[model samples]
Target: MVDRYVAAVDQGTTSTRCILFDHAGRLAAVAQREHRQHLPRPGWVEHDAQEILRNVLRVVGEAVQDVGAGPGQVVALGIANQRETTVLWDPRTGQPYGHAVVWQDLRTEARVEELAADGGRDRFRDVCGLPLTTYFAGPRIAWLLDATPGLRDAAAAGHVLFGTVDSWLVWNLTGGPDGGVHVTDVTNASRTMLMDLAGRHWSPALCEAMGVPMQILPEIRSSAEVYGLTGGPVAEVLPGVPVAAALGDQQAALFGQTCFAPGEAKCTYGTGSFVLINTGATPVTAEHGTLPTVAYQIGDEPAAYALEGAIAVTGSLVQWFRDGLGMIATAPDIEGLALSVPDNGGCYIVPAFSGLFAPHWRPDARGVVVGLTSFVTRAHLARAVLEATAWQTRDVVDAMDADSGLRLTSLRVDGGMTSNNLLMQTVADVLGVPVVRPMVSETVSLGAAYAAGLAVGWWPDLEGLRRNWHRAGEWLPHADPAAVARGHEDWTRAVQHSFGWSREPSSHDGGAPSAQPGR
Candidate 1:
């Protein structure tokens, strides 16, 4: 008998990857390709949707071939994408109007401020469970509609279609411009600021406020269901496989980590770091800066809610260090450079490169490296870079505790950055809890595969998926409490220096002039 597998495509900030998972939740094979990041202007980031889709096809084919599996041997395909990367396309031609606005792009910052001017950022918090931040799809869509001539009119007439990356992939995969299914999962829709949290449908008032047309929206579906099948261009690789699930990459990580119960939490440290705590059936209001979001929804089941603390700079900070500064030869080299120093040498780096997120949603803030002195060396700066991510996670954990009213005892961690032992230990030390990595580190793809498999009855249930989780490594808190408190206080002081540094209008163009040295 041939072994069956579930395939998942993880459309990330900087790359697209396809992974195959066996029934026991073990990774069978994987293929990935990085797409170009277009930064036309300061504080702007865009991606060619066409390039991403092509890479998706290539990676999918490569992953399947790597496993020596035929299309029939693959049970289902799922998608986990970088949420809020907005794409608007002409359904007639299956062509995007422009590049997809990345979640990290702050080009919509002015629009966000204008919307929040009257009602403040929490104006639509009750309706959408999201603040008016540049990190969502709504403002980006609005900006595109306004910036592009006749786009609003086209959208109203149903000539244009709006979706996050998941909807885009599913549409094209099923059969773009050839009777493709246009739909978005509840998890991805929840991040759009156009969906009603309780109702689990598009909020009419939000669509009007964001200048988005209801006609352009996709049919909102559950995270796990047979939405469509690979029929069009996708047929060349995954022909006729059930497209079973879709999720925001962070939410996918939560599901992938098997945090199925209330108060259970996971943090994915990727391009950005997101800490999500399962709040169960009820959507927890954002009282403490954490965004309430749909974790995942099975077929017809009530949507599971999570409180998320989104940090905009974690792994990307490392990328900037490598590419922007040429400080290290590679991303992983920073770990060894950091270990060369016993400590941060009284330095702290608050990586608010595109402003801070979570606990402090200060868009005006910029990255800052403080406590710098002549005594500090390049090695110390590397240590400070790693510590910045740990401190940010600590901030989110604190906020999650307040919002959910549940203390995080231990955190299930995943993503590329988790492999750094120093960073993992720093996270455990900062949070005073055990930081644990699962045997399978690619939880985003795994979660998508798990949901897909569950939908197709390949996996028994959540209990079985939970049993597949095995610990690969663990880091425990080892720092002195008093010393840790002092360090945190200093870090907080450094964070304060980042705020109010970019208050002027043109300052939003990119990082503050003062932040240039740090970057």
Candidate 2:
């Protein structure tokens, strides 16, 4: 059943999207649905795992139906979900115990502080390419077990399944009421603190340290391997379709954008912006606390490793301007309004609304805006917000280069935010490298397409995806070094002003994580 098309279900932070690609790597159809984000308390974020699963089913069905394809026509399914969004579910019934604790949720900040205070925060860079923080799944899962009553019982009964969204959906889709496969791809597993980077399996030491049991975990597998066919109730849409790939959104983007060579990088501008540098076969253990994780795994490529840089707030900040403050009518309107001002006009925003990530793992860091003057208008604030995203990413790229030794010459940019030409050009000017935008901004979906195609023989391997890749636009270095330097200096000072402040309880006792403390 080699239909000329591959389907990708990209379950992203703000939306669930499905994209269909023909045999030649051309996009045939796309379906997107925006779901709700529940913020019950400040500094907390959540999504309904069941609702997300529903969206994935609905969108994929519509995409295939619009393309006039059936189960036999759609050869394989690849899933790339928002990484680090932790889900704890009843393995037997496929029901989430509570809302999916979003990657952005800071409810675990106190837990991270508890670990750090107990000396567990010391040199976490060894096995898990991350520190003790709320960003990863370990703390969130612990919070659920300790805080959610039924969870501990479920875990002890061996019925609780812990996973990022990829594992959750895969289990539900292929994991049936009778018996569905419970597995997670390596790329997504790397983000959880449980997996050992070198061994590429759940680490006993890590599980013990994080107060989690090994029994409830899923068997970790590679990104491109066929977990199973989509044979559950959702199969009502595309019956008997092979689910070939499951990757974290960032790794999927890296693969989808053809960043195969070492040092190749891509920046995804979603709810939170992510910058990942492909370090190739060998894992680059971050000397400076930049996340080191698996990029992706294919047939026998060993596990391609990567260095990750995360900006906890990117597109979400734009949402703040649109929804919270009512600055702009829509998200896209931000680029034009920000372009109205040449600069931040002495206003700088550090969106540590939860806590800052990457290079710096401070859970006490808080969002700050410095140098707000009487002359500051919505446009200046808008420009500052856009520039803030660029600045944070620039710091991440710098840290990535330092740690990986891959002199990043350019960055492939995707996600919802890259549509802003002003932001892309500004990111280029600040980083002093070309920022490339691809023909398909939905790199997650495209990466999923590549994976599903390869597994089912609709497309070749990574090289085949590379050959089919093409660029739509590129933002070259557009700022003088001196000007960028001065702007950065001002940004650095404002950053220092925002350090040690947090949206956490007083136990953590500092601001939420600060900016990447000056390289």
Candidate 3:
């Protein structure tokens, strides 16, 4: 008998990856390719949507080929993508109007500010469960309409379509212009700021507020269900496999971690770090700057909600150290260089590269490296880089605790960055919680596979998935309390310095920007 497998395409901010998994949830084969990140302006970030689609198709073919599996043996394809990366395309020609506005891009800051001024931020809180920030897709799409000529008119006329990365990949995979299903999962739709949290559908009111026509929105569906079959160029490789599941990457990580019960939480350290704590069926309006989002919805089951704290830069900070500073030849080299120093040497590297996100929401903020002195070496900066990742995780975990009232004694961690022992230990030390890395660190992809596999009856149920999860390693907090406090104090001071750097005097009334009105 031939062994059946599920393929998961995880399209992330920095790269695209495909992983094949067997029934046991073991990774059979994997392929990845990094793409260009177009930083056209100080606060603008873009990606070629077509390039991402090409990378996705290539990696999927490579992974399946490496595993010696035919398309028939592949039960289904699951998609987990970087959330909130907006792409607008013409359905007729299957070409994007322009580059995708990345989630980290702050190009929508002024637009978000305009909406916030009109009481748009808090007004939709009850419906969408998100604030007006550059982090969500609504503002970015709105900005695209105003910035891109003829695009808005086309969208209004139903000639153009809008989707986050997951929707884009799924559209092309199914058939693109040739009868491809245009849809987004509930989890992805929740981040768009146009979906009603309780109703689980597009809100015409919010659409009017953002000036986005409802005609261009994708159909909202559950996280696990057959959206369509592979077609077009994707059919050349994955011919008829059903697209069984689609999830925002972080939510996929949560499911991949088997955090099925309320209060169970996980933090995925990828291009950015997201800490999501399951809140069960009821959406908890966050009071601590955390965003309320859909976790996942399995077949006819009620949608699960999560209180999320998102940090826009984590692993990418290491990337900058490699590419920008040339401190390390590769990403992995940073771990060794960071360990060379006993500490950060009192330095704090706050990488607000696209401006601060989550808990702060300061789009005016810029990257700042504080406490730099003549005595500081490259090793100290490297250590600071790793420390920043830990501190940022602590910031979200702290807010998650405050909002959910669930004290996190341990964190279920996944993603590429979790492989760094030094970074993992620092995370444990800073958060004062045990950090557990799963045996299969590709939980993001596995989560996608789990959803698809479950849909096709590849796995019996959630209990089967629970048994598949096993911890590979663990880290416990060993730092002294005083040291942690001192480090955090200095980190807070450094973050303060980063704010108000790019904002016009009028934006802040010639004073420091006020805390975003509500959590």
Candidate 4:
């Protein structure tokens, strides 16, 4: 690879992004486009798969131009994406059957309950390292097959193909219908509930249970591997440039945050918040409700495991405050607005905007604000929103610690929400551990760069990657532990009240609730 630059695609739920990072891991430029969010029914969300592809191309071209770097300087291209967004399309024409079933879509709650009632959910989770829910791809794939006409037959006849965003992009970039490599990284595949956690292959039992054809699935590959070359319309930028690495965005962020050692964890605050603890090369099965996931897989090496806590809301609540309610003029203004009030004023906000996840595992919960009084102003409401995220994060941390038997020395945080000083401060106070902020907030892409750079010798190894990690700041708790403890109790109470609240979509049909956006 002659070039020192890498083009990293970080596609998310609300937007598609492309960023350029040099070999030294410095940010060069970024291009992003917010696409349409379709809510065909309450609690259900979808995105056009083809529009996502279009946004990717536009953003990639723009980012390259911004840095005066194009495909030629892009030594390698790496992909990191929102895991569990299931895509199904015509193999012959490369056209999607309909919108992509977003991770936030809640259309399969009743179906999940049906599986659980049948006694198959428990057995599958034991083998797959994931629970039976709409949060994973297997269920979404099943939903698409059962809801869409001819999809089942098409999949069976090998006329349709299934993939997460990584597989979709690879197929489009490498010649789409003409023929692109069909592959998914182990990280993304892990969220599908179809891949064996230990063997890392599509499990026959899981597929049969979900009623999906194995032929439609992509071959799972290691996180860091040269998948193939670009061959489609966008090939002019850098034809035959190797696609070196691929990872689920959260896993990429974990690597990018330099959490290479066991027990090291990071929480990425975005539309939703996910906390992942790296437990290198050993599947640390959690007896306590946390999930065991593959952090990353390299070559034939043993897979790294993680204990994950999935929260539905984080920054989006703040977005709602600004856009939906007009509580604040802008998102960044939330920090000051929240800080304007000394506390939540005895109020607790349970942001189960879609539903609650992990520890509680309740699909019936909805967003609620408890302990409200006339004295509570918008500032207090703002503060409650920020505090709620911290409290929810602590819940995950506590569960992870209980399950893994590892006390966290500090919690590493990244993503757009981490930029808020007040939120970070509150998070530190609540977690009772120092919150370490990295110099590069875009750890998602950096993780992709780390894996891809290591693949082609741009990086010598994990040690070199850690040595180059740049930490920006650290925040520690300065408040009374007792007060924080009381605040946590209040938050839990608010969570309970959030349940059976009105106006939130519970399920697609009548099963376990779909995992919606947490904010």
Off by over 4 Å in 2: 1-3, 36-45, 147-154, 316-355, 362-382, 500-519
Which ranges in model 4 have alpha carbons more than 4 Å from their true place?
1-3, 70-72, 120-123, 323-326, 372-378, 500-513
Instruction: Estimate, for each residue in 90-168, the C-alpha lDDT of model 2 and write its tens digit.
Output: 7677788889998877788777776778655543557876666666888788888999867787789887888899888
- The backbone clash count of each candidate, in order, is 0, 14, 0, 7
Candidate 1 residues 484-514, lDDT tens each? Answer: 8999999999999998887666423221121
Models sorted by TM-score, best on top: 4, 1, 2, 3
- The TM-scores of all predictions, comma-separated, are 0.91, 0.88, 0.87, 0.91
Better of 1 and 2 by lDDT: 1
- Model 2 RMSD to the real structure? 3.6
- What local distance difference test score does each model get? 0.88, 0.82, 0.87, 0.83
**Model 3, residue 377: what's the lDDT?**
97
At residue 475, candidate 3 shows an lDDT of 99
Error of 4 at 459 (Å): 1.1
The deviation in Å at residue 111 for candidate 4 is 2.8
Which of 2 and 4 is ahead in lDDT?
A: 4
| Model 2: lDDT to the true structure | 0.82
Write down the lDDT that model 3 would get.
0.87
